[model samples]
Target: MAITSDDVRHLAELSNLSVTEEEIEPLKKDLGAIVEYISQLDELNTEGVEPTYQCFEMENVWREDEITEFEAKRKDLLNLAPESTDNQIKVPKVL
Candidate 1:
């Protein structure tokens, strides 16, 4: 696919970039070369190759969720708070 000035301009607009007139030609050449290089992948022959998802042999290590006792007590935590009422920390009202 040929990268025209309009294509470059459209890309710039989509990317929220401000490109000058001087940068248009260079951008067009650069983008065209990149697309051409990537298009080489179309020449590859993969008849029965499995698509790769994860590059590494890694998986989720899940463990059973168990409730554990905490060292800090509720009363102690409440006392450390800047302000607390009704056994809960109080903060300034937000709009």
Candidate 2:
């Protein structure tokens, strides 16, 4: 695939990049080479081959969700607070 200057300019615009007039020719050549290289994958024989999504063996280890009682009681926590009103902690009023 041959990448033209116009293609490079369009790609630059889509990518929100500022490409100089001198950089366009080099970018076109580089991009053309990259596309050609990637196109070589079409020549591979992938028949009956399962697409491997992950290279490493992975699994989701799940456990039953249980609510355990906290060691500190509500009264204990309220006592530790700087200021408490009724059964809740009190903070400075905000606008």
- Candidate 2 Cα deviation (angstroms), residue 22: 1.2
Residue-level lDDT of model 1, residues 1-95, one tens digit each, is 89999999999999999999999999999999999999998899988999998888878878889888999999999999999999999999998
Judge candidate 1 against the unseen true structure and give its global Cα lDDT, from 0 to 1: 0.95
What local distance difference test score does each model get?
Answer: 0.95, 0.93
Candidate 1, pairs of clashing residues: none
Worst 10 residues of 2 by lDDT: 54-63
RMSD of each: 10.0, 12.5
In model 2, which runs have C-alpha deviations exceeding 4 angstroms?
A: 47-95
Which tens-of-lDDT digit does each residue in 1-95 have in candidate 2?
79999999999999999999999989998999999999999999999999988787776768789898899999999999999989999999987
Report lDDT (Cα) of residue 1, candidate 2. Answer: 78
